[model samples]
Target: MAALTIFWDDLSVETALDFCEYLVRSEDYKLRDLAIWIQGSGGPIDELDGSIGSLVALWSWFKSFREQGLPGVPLGARAAYSVITGRPLDSPLEEGSRLVGESVAHYVFKVILSLDPTAHWAVRAKSGRIAHAWDNTPGISMDGGKHFGPAVGFFTNYPDRLSSNYHNAYAAREAWDDTGLLQSVELLYLAGLPSRPRSTSTTESILSPLLRDDHVGSGHREEIPIAQEMPASITNNGPVSAGAEELIFASVGADVSRLDQAAPLDELAVASVLAELGFVSADGQSVSAVTLLSHGVQVQNVDGFALVETHVAGGRLRGLFLEPMRPSEKEWKSITDAFSALGEKLPAHLANER
Candidate 1:
């Protein structure tokens, strides 16, 4: 069976309502089920606070259908509630509506078939049209019946068939500029269809010429392997050593102590250290705990002196760089509490650090 998918971009609540009305009024479309997936209360409404108003209106409309028995309303009260709350309803009617909407939105027109079906030819042909027109390319024929005009003719005449189908679908399904609601629906339908298999003779016909003795490996003839080449070594006999050997160690700011005996001095630690130093609390006190932690310093290693580095770009360290070395339960709790206290003051500290 064929399916259909409809999509609307940046459509306001008012527009959606009008669309729903149109669908109901139109005699051509026999909508099996309909569901609306609103992004949020950001839809266009006349009232200043239209978000709340639209929800109320939707709710009222749904209530009217449930209580008064409106003639063309497909969604029930529970379905309406689910739409408002953005959650699934437990009831059967609501679940059906939810399934319909979600299926349409994500997988409505997509065709599924077995690996080798008896009616593959017709199914493949129908599916190919949907797939071909999915590219937002204008004028590519949707099927043999309709030709994509000059603007999108490139798709129809594309040299690479596979490349054309892939690109076409991508553009139609995802491209916002050229593809609108109708085109998206058509593309979705095409995608939902099953793929067909090529006849054995057809496959062999396309492959045989390329595999013929004269053309075999025409572009991939075997060649002798090249010998491995070694890079030239640089020789600097004049100054072999600068008299002093420098050892550089790189570690997270929190784990800098691990470098204490490995190197003479630590020049840079992870960026977290600087962020802690500049933190300020709401009561005008410096956030010492956050600062210390950011600088890769903790109560356990108070005596350790290490340079702190951070991941901040532009040659600066602005945040904490402490490592949690097998943190004890108490230490973890303390850290969490410190963060909770510091969270409120983070914005100002971040600005100052910047």
Candidate 2:
């Protein structure tokens, strides 16, 4: 399976590195000393150790953000209203900045920075911090996609891959930090940028003598490279490439260890497995092309992913069908094992699929 791609607002690499430092310190204070030792800041600001996983993730995110052509966007005025009302209509403004809703998200906790301010989707501040804040929504659109809300869009009008990336990142973090929630994030500003050489007389940094003076210049801007095809190796890339000899390997998150076990299977067999797994029923529409259902399930290519229903205990259950993506040569066993593993870790959401 392909590595999940997330669109991020392209910013200076210096800023990205700064953010990396913040990620390091936030995740492990011990690393703060290591960063200082390595002269990550060229001097000690706080305090550190040797680990650096969070820093690497942030740095990788910066590189991938440009590769994937992602941009940061803030939510609109009426999106929160629409999410709550279940209507397509925009909400009316109230008192300018506060969109009086219970349990609305804290803007800072957003996967991306919150840049817009609308009363309809406004969230209250923590107590004693002044409840409401307002600002203008800087409108930016690409290929006609919503900037925020329940259905925020991603990449060249792609179905929100950022959401998947966010989920995967969250899972990765959960795998890493088993203690509790890690908050109070630090962000890096774009401090150094590489510039094109103007003359041979240019100098270098004292910290890293190999570094170019132009790269650390006062005004530096360079076009970030694009890497849209990076996911081809692991992505089904539209089961369009399917042939009698080809097998689609559907993958969830960063786990693709089972992909080598792939083998081709027809639509009927795939559908039957889903049915047996309780993801779909025999009466449901026949599997063909990718089709989104009102029930939040989608049948796509030879490999598909969906949010399916599973009853747990006396109530109901909803879990991500990561199991479906793990197809193998032993087709029947793969299907059964997929569903069985899923049953072992069924998620607890009983509400209608999102």
Candidate 3:
């Protein structure tokens, strides 16, 4: 095998530190020698200690690794152990360094095996490869590539690598062996496989006609009390003066009846109603006459014989009006005709009433 060349991506720094600590504690390298090497790396010993402290703090902050589905082992335990024991886990010597470094993956595999000795063949295969790679080249990249190929292969081949025990792991390794590609592809396939469809059942209930009748039997179901109060309709008894091109009318009250009762009219609906009344532009519609009477109510009173009241506070139509009684029979007929035409477009309930 080409000497496994491990390249550590930024994410692998912590893992590398952990592995280094593991090697040191295992007595593979001398701590004093490692310290000396650190000293020789152009930084003062105090700086190295500060750097170590920062790394430890980072590890401590990421203590929720267990919650994120990682093992419960404190992050910097191995490193701390090495420092305390005054041992160098990594060697400056090329061969000894390589050997100790390679053993890191094996140690990890052993730790995993200790948990479940009869781990699946796929797991064993993956562990073996990782151990092999670590022993051969301890500096693997975290990014997916040939450098981190074995780790990716292990995970990709065994989709349940982190979940299920070694059975799936073995299967993935076997598939990878059969095909020359890394096990990662197989793992991807297993992960991407759709789960079985779930079955759903719905039940419907039918009520007896008698029960339906009983439910609506009470006619007093929150009826709005139509008070005997009615506003006096405006009267335009004056002669047809030449300057009187249009007549304006206005009204204010607690109750404003919507022109269309089939469906409730909102502010937009009130605006729509005004547009239909010719007071507003029919083609390029705009809220021409509609004005907020107070923050509590909206009033639309155009310089035509029409007034519409909508309760802005309650956000509902309260009343509508076609005002100014025409003294002439011809004018009355014209007003009635205009109202009838407008009524046609009103909601079914109000249109029916008209």
Candidate 4:
């Protein structure tokens, strides 16, 4: 095959670096605010914490360019920066921002594609949302081939790759330019830099001596908050690890309300209740009680927490799955004890086998 032509290859590295500095300097807090907004709204993507962590790492990487100069940045990152900066200025802000976001998605596309691209599709296939959507809804196309086209044909023929959770987020967009999440995040990453340059120049430019330094005035830089003083919650960017007791209580909270329902609770009803609690079957649909008891169900997004039914001396028991680490055996026992406290013991005969 002929060598592929990268459109942004011709853009000067200095210009791209300036753009990166500008974005980081101008956009960081707004990005955090957007992340908080998404978390508060319970948006489709559950990786806000992960995204924040990535942003933090990216900030450190960008800062390294100052001490090490241009050689410090990876070639891929340089290309990525050029790609982001080369986006057409005349395009709609939403469209431009989305393109910029995709360029910086080293966290997802680059990492996945670097590992056998074809096999990564299997990972997406196994995703709860993608698998559920694929299995149940045959008509709605998950293929990005038409929408994303050939622009991102690196991993596969453009548009051939299935839509990621990031793509699905657009289906439920509430705010205008919800697609700009990545752009805001990129700005937030830049926001971590020092407010004013150490030099005599009034403008704050990244990497001491690069091109024109007048773009970001000292006054403008002063307006951006110092990243260090931000709240721990914003900086940490991970879900608060709820205690096992709290997790179990929240997980089973619906069971109490279901007691008054007309029909007796069966395995399927139990599965639906678990589904409401954010547990899903292997195929990502509403889990069945049989599956929960037999195979166990997975909790989406947040790490840890699985539903398992066990045969104990008293009877068949259902509770959160635990291991030696993570929640530890003691933490798992705490969940089980909490369940027992709730009086949820079931007879062995009620336990369904696969």
Q: Give the best candidate by lDDT.
A: 4
Per-residue lDDT of 140 in model 2: 24
- Where is model 4 poorest over a 10-residue stretch in terms of lDDT? 133-142
Q: Could you give candidate 1's per-residue lDDT for residues 122-230 as a string of tens digits?
A: 1111122111212222111233333222211221111111133245445544433222322332332243222342222211112123323465232432221221211
TM-score of each model, in listed order: 0.17, 0.20, 0.19, 0.25
Q: List, residue by residue over 50-138, the lDDT tens digit for candidate 3.
A: 11122222122222221243232223333322222233234223223222223333322222222332321121112221112123322
lDDT of 2 at 277: 45
**lDDT tens per residue, model 2, 1-354:** 222211222222333334323322232222222232234423321211111112232323323332433222113432322222232223232211112110011211122222111212211112221111111121122222323322221111121123453454445443322122222121111111112212221122122321334432323222223322212213333332221121222323312233223222233333445555444322345432122112234432222333332211112111223323422334334444654454344311111112
Compute the lDDT for candidate 2: 0.26
Cα distance off (Å), candidate 3, residue 229:
36
Better of 1 and 3 by TM-score: 3
- C-alpha lDDT of all candidate models, in order: 0.27, 0.26, 0.29, 0.30
Window of ten residues with lowest summed lDDT in model 3 = 201-210
> What is the lDDT for 322 in model 4?
31
Highest TM-score against the true fold, candidate: 4
In candidate 1, which residue ranges exceed 4 Å CA deviation?
A: 1-76, 79-178, 181-251, 254-354
